[model samples]
Target: MAPLRSRRRRALAVPVGLALTASLGFLPGSATAAAPQTADAPASAAEAGPELSYVVNTETGAGTVGKVKKAIAKAGGTVVTAHDRIGVIVVHSANPDFARTMRTAEGVQSAGATRTAPLKAAGTTEVGKPEKVREPRSAAALAAARASGQEPLESLQWDIAAIRADKAAEVNPGSRKVTVAVIDTGVDDTHPDLAPNFSAKQSANCVGGLADTGKGAWRPYTEDDYHGTHVAGEIAAARNNVGVAGVAPGVKVSSIKVSEAETSLFYAEAVVCAFMFAADQGIEVTNNSYYIDPWMFNCKDDPDQGAIVEAVSRAAKFAGRKGAIHVASAGNSSFDLAAKSLTDTSSPNDTTPVERTVDPSKCLDIPTQLPGVVTVSATGPKALKSYYSNYGLNQIDVAGPGGDKYQVPEAPAKDGRILSTMPGGDYAYLQGTSMAGPHVAGVAALIKSKRPDASPQEIQWLLKAHADNPGCPTEPYDPDGDGKVNAECTGTQHINSFYGFGIVDALDAVEK
Candidate 1:
């Protein structure tokens, strides 16, 4: 619908962070790349060719891992890192057949290149930048905000009130013991609002299949890398009377930078590293705003794409087993994910996109459609499904305020987009399912704080239980009022395609 409006902003500027020359070894906390076992061979791994990154998933065990690494070495590939616990190995090689060769290793379950492009592939596309938000001009609202214990910029945030986060904070600001990880482009811990609650110890740069937890490793590479910072602000910006307060302001937040510096592409290698690092660190939650790149939808039937899905799914499953709950955006294409077949024109985003028809049932969006993730859809201030949000009867778990340009707020707040912290300590407006995922992550963090001992599955159950469903719209679901229907809402009033179990409620998370 409407040319598939997936707003994953990227720049045509000089690309950085794609040079994968890091020495081989498991990072202190993170291990190999995430999952799969086969692909036909084009050439032997020993033959020199363009450098590419690959993940080799194998049977878990020291013996199995050793045999796999030996196989990787014999195939003329360098071991970027090997995760013995999960049987995933991040390998780099100029050998054209590294992935195909590894698939034959005795203990290997799956193997495939993480990208169709070379090691230093650059993005050829560009997206519009986010708009910088100014202070609300109403003096009466400013005075009221100051008097009501709201932060300086809190008056500009209608999203907090939309999900009753403002009221939830008053009852309980949430426990700092719970930490949610923003697994995206880097985060700026220096922002005044985020600095206080940011957890440096848990943060790292998981770029190019390696995790670096050194001081400031988690900071954004450039001012334009603001997605993670905006996401962090939405989840746990401090309550101190500085800027806008977060939904769970008292909880701690960490950053696991997975996107390439300028291209802002999230390759599978980086994604796997981020998930493994977060889960190993005992992180309670992770917010995944973007899909695993190269492919928008990784089909399990295709050998290479299948391995990409398996790698990501394995890491996500491991995180769940390790007590980390993942919250991901339901996507912005506005397609019915439950539909039988859909046309996809964005596969292999790293080099060039090739159009292909795919079945939603088999061609899944990684991590988002992966089992055990709290898949969130976007909603506007009016408590309606956002025009850009993807929906399916049983796919969406909950809805959150991701903002909408059409759903303008009242006097105090002017912009309909979600207001959040940018890199250089500035505030801006960005609207997408990317923004929506953090809200769900924040609410889940609140649940973790209140229940302290609950498992990931239990926390997910609580989220669906406490949500306030707005059921499918009784009238034709057209926000623009155009004669043509923008999107059709399906399912019963209680749990439908658009609102999932309904909009998330922060107040009930603590009280219930």
Candidate 2:
């Protein structure tokens, strides 16, 4: 296993009060009363104005949330909802001039229309009937059969197939079932490939209002937001014909809608609630793909923020002790988590003051950064760092095929495609550390299925021990100045910020 490196000197501060609110409006009897009755119609009906979402940019400063709310009211607009973590406000207005006005509002950085539509309800549909497996197949035979196209599978990646085959050989196909909780925008419980694997009777929607209502329920949840479906497919989509195979095909999935959209803050309360529900149902693994920037947490010292972090940490730890594993995306910021600077050469072109260093003391991604959770980074087929993934000698625990944009000379076209389930009865091509997280989570499930006696820590150790080392011939200079890349480390012989323990090798992990 990769040695646990030095503590990151520049871990970012955790934010506070960025949690999502359960109710849309202030309580009727609350001291802070709702706005007085107005002649204007509701904001949703207002003429099509530019849709808007806010992003918080400062850790120590206040956001324009209140101002945005007030402006929405003054402009005859209604706030569909507000997310404190990312400091986003989803509002609708009839006036096309609203965006211009909002741009000038106090505390407002910027506002614009969301790329996706509002959430919708996905109806229940039977993609295929569940079948009982009488026996498990040998790993070698399964791999040979899949290679010969004898099984109905979706992923073209040989590694994924090999991993699944190994998992199938180790356990009783029916006795060892894994339950993966998906915490994202929302999932379409009705999609054919996904439907057979869902534990709907055991699932719940925590996005507010009646269960399964709001934009959260829409079919092909991908139309509005595909994050949840994509993650779910990676963990447990059925192996039957029609789509790609999940890492743990025999595992069951539970949908937990924590974020309404990608930028929205998934409330700490919602997360706790989801974990509690999963615990109650005996779910074995929980996968989180969304993250709020550091500034939204208001720094880790705030009482409220600290409490939320502690609660999440405790819950995840509890799940681990109970035999479940928690996995999360390390984030897409491309920052050197220990040095706290933009690690990606491409980051300069994406943000202001291109060369400005990212402060490590104020920038870690939640849940992933929290203790006890297994954080994962992204890698391509060639096993190189993905340009968009965040990395740190100690922050990231493992890497997986999250899909890199650059082409690989040996396997150019094979470099970046990840085949996973999508909404609307189709498959999709997604690329992110988000895609990488589930791959590890699914492997954890496979380990658990084979060795139900293995503890969470033991499973984590097993994964680390089997990781593929992507040896960098020479360590790059610590450009961001977090201290020279630990001189004690040689090439990729040991851990480095750019690539954690190395690329995930399913065949190696299962064999161990």
Candidate 3:
């Protein structure tokens, strides 16, 4: 799927612009002057209301957090949340001068007015097939299959019979109930195969001012992106004939639309609201397939940028704390996340070379980059890295089958081979890291269903420990270095960047 761009029109201010410049290693004092704030004079203190957050300098060390908090309190601003890593202080105040006052305060770095609102429901986008209701496959057939005790299937493509056979021995298919939230465009609650698994409550579109589809109020009425529907099917398509089965056949799915064919800003409020809804609905697992690229250079870690991350992180943490697991796509952009410099770091002697820096005007990658969220990368059925799938050893937790037909070095014969659900019909072949994310998500739901007591971290560790390492070279494509692959470029016994922990092993995860 093509990436959605940001639609925010307002230009950033001085501190923010300066921060972006500094992040790119540009001289701090060399930044261009920012445009005037607003034409109208500052609103009265009462009209301005209280400030909600204070943006801080990324250069400020950790020690500055307490000092900044003290200052906020002295200003009668109640600190609601503090993001130390990104230097942001979420507060409750309507003060219009909050940004100006905090910018001048010692250790304050920068301050800006922040807004927080309740996440609203999203409207239905595309309407596909209705949900499906099915009778349990023969218990006798399942018993006999288990009695044979044959080895589990090994093909990368999803096999329903195989999953059922393997899980039948230990899992009571009826007893394992899991709710997976598809936080993407939307789902076709009417799809025959998906109907049985969808929540009776119609899905919600969080986009504001959108038409109210029967699914939810205020959801935008738009063309079916088919993104979320495909994802939903991959996680819980019923075991009926006419299509492939999901990793977890019996799990339930809840659709939450947070994106459109338009822009990311159109869905920003929707995204935040989706997270809040997921937490309140007791939905255990959420699959986020969308993301915003990093903003301006130094602005990668700017408070505004970090605010979204922190908010998402808090929501994920809340879900985790509530026994839910959040899974997101690592992204399709291939870059060494650890090696990329978002800010200028002063070497011991301030002599280290500074190369390309990320743009801070862009919003940092979402859901995947958010803390406490399990970021997943894509791998072909052959266990090779999908050319389009992004990789960051530290960021991506695992890999799964996301058919990659559009990468460099002509896509292999199996290029367009992702096993997922398609609208208007049952399961079909599709490809992308978007396809890969749900495979892991379905497996996660299965794990949670089978081991209800396991913590989110424990489940993550279990999945990682059981992954099958796809031995891809460690030295990323060296365009200029000697063509030969070096020894250090080889795979080790454990985790590596190309394939974090390795391709997810369903059998091992379920058994472990």
Candidate 4:
């Protein structure tokens, strides 16, 4: 099965003599196997089975809530919450037949369980184990940064410099009024670098498809699941002079935890709640660094996959309509999303995966392909496509520095992976389109901060209009230096698959 991007790290040659940290989560070119569940889910339920989560999608503009509620009840399911405006209903039921029965009910367009595992499934999957890295920076690097009035680790941030974020900060440090919601795993608000700018009121844990506003519930369980924290740090870590700074250091950030606590799976219902929460809270921008799990690509023709896509697509569009701009990663598989056909061996990741060839047009990568969403691809220090970043002639909307350890840029940036805050206030280097999406999001936040009255559509336009169009590489694209061609570039400097309009430009975003 193709491993999910979040769980994978880029392969790079470790500089000799660099001491390895003890907890290196996974090797440079490898991934840790998904942790096994603690116990097997019951094969069959007793008279009263454990409650399972389901999502019921109603036709748009249909005033069918009353009818849907009755149908849910008749199917032995209890309504958890209803996003009536978007026509999505979250439910819980012990009856295995709940989805099948609800499909026949009036006003219900499609209904399906959100997870393959039963609700009673126990145990947790340990994710984001720390990877090997050189020991903490020596006093020399710190002294150099301090002498230059930069953050302690700022010199290592080539990604920021690639888009001239350092220069943009001078133009406008951004405004506190703009909040970029990190809609992934969760954020560690207590990190010293993030504490000054974290927005608690706008944060929530939507792991079970319902909003959990309990105290501190929006934070990740631990750094082991540090994907969200890393993405958050990339967007809005404070310019506190202590740790590394973010692209838009002056903006506020909110944590909207959508991935399941143990499995790290981003289910459809959780994602639905996340977008809705961002909209209701008046968040101006949101960064989606991961795709919905179990199914890597959801085809519209398949009933189950169709429901998943329909429900989440409506929720994302609803967020856009409510004035929030959504930006997402283009995936890390390096496949051409605009291609006619591709092989997908890793899907239904929650269960056994089977190899299947899918038509990219019919099999949509939700949120990324959904209308009004800005799809971001990853570029390395040398301004080339990150070897693993997915691209397409028409799929990419923008490019950003996601780091390529093997394709290091120049002096000061010894490593190619993007560095950001981890759970315990520590920092780590990681790479993927997951790291690239936030660069655009942070730039989007800067745009919103500058034009506070602009609509989401207007902001999206400004984002593309103001980007720096660095055309595709003139030479054959090959980061590994192997003779074989990796991927081909098509289109002009204005538009292409590796980069949509162009690479995101922080300086242009905040400029008048």
TM-score, one value per model: 0.90, 0.62, 0.64, 0.89
Rank order (by TM-score, best first): 1, 4, 3, 2
Query: Against the unseen true structure, what C-alpha lDDT does each candidate score?
Result: 0.78, 0.52, 0.51, 0.76
For TM-score, the strongest prediction is: 1
Clash numbers, per candidate: 8, 19, 38, 7
Q: What tens digits encode model 3's per-residue C-alpha lDDT throughout 140-182? A: 6455434554211112233332223236323533223678888
Q: Judged by lDDT, which candidate is best?
A: 1
List RMSD in Å for every model shown. 7.3, 13.2, 11.9, 7.1
Q: List ranges where model 4 is wrong by over 4 Å.
A: 1-3, 6-51, 59-63, 122-143
Clashes of 1: 8
Q: How well does model 1 score by local distance difference test?
A: 0.78
Higher-scoring candidate on TM-score, 1 or 3: 1
**TM-score, model 3 to reference:** 0.64
After aligning candidate 2 to the native by TM-score, how far in Å is the CA of 91 from where it should be?
A: 22
Candidate 1 stretches greater than 4 Å from native: 1-47, 122-128, 136-144
Residue-by-residue lDDT tens digits, candidate 1, 236-352: 999887778899999999999887865677888898999899988999999888878767787786666777788888888888899999998888777789999988776666666
Please list the residue runs of candidate 2 whose C-alpha ends up more than 4 Å from where it truly belongs after superposition: 1-147, 150-155, 158-176, 208-222, 261-264, 293-298, 340-363, 409-415, 473-492
- Give candidate 2's whole-model lDDT: 0.52
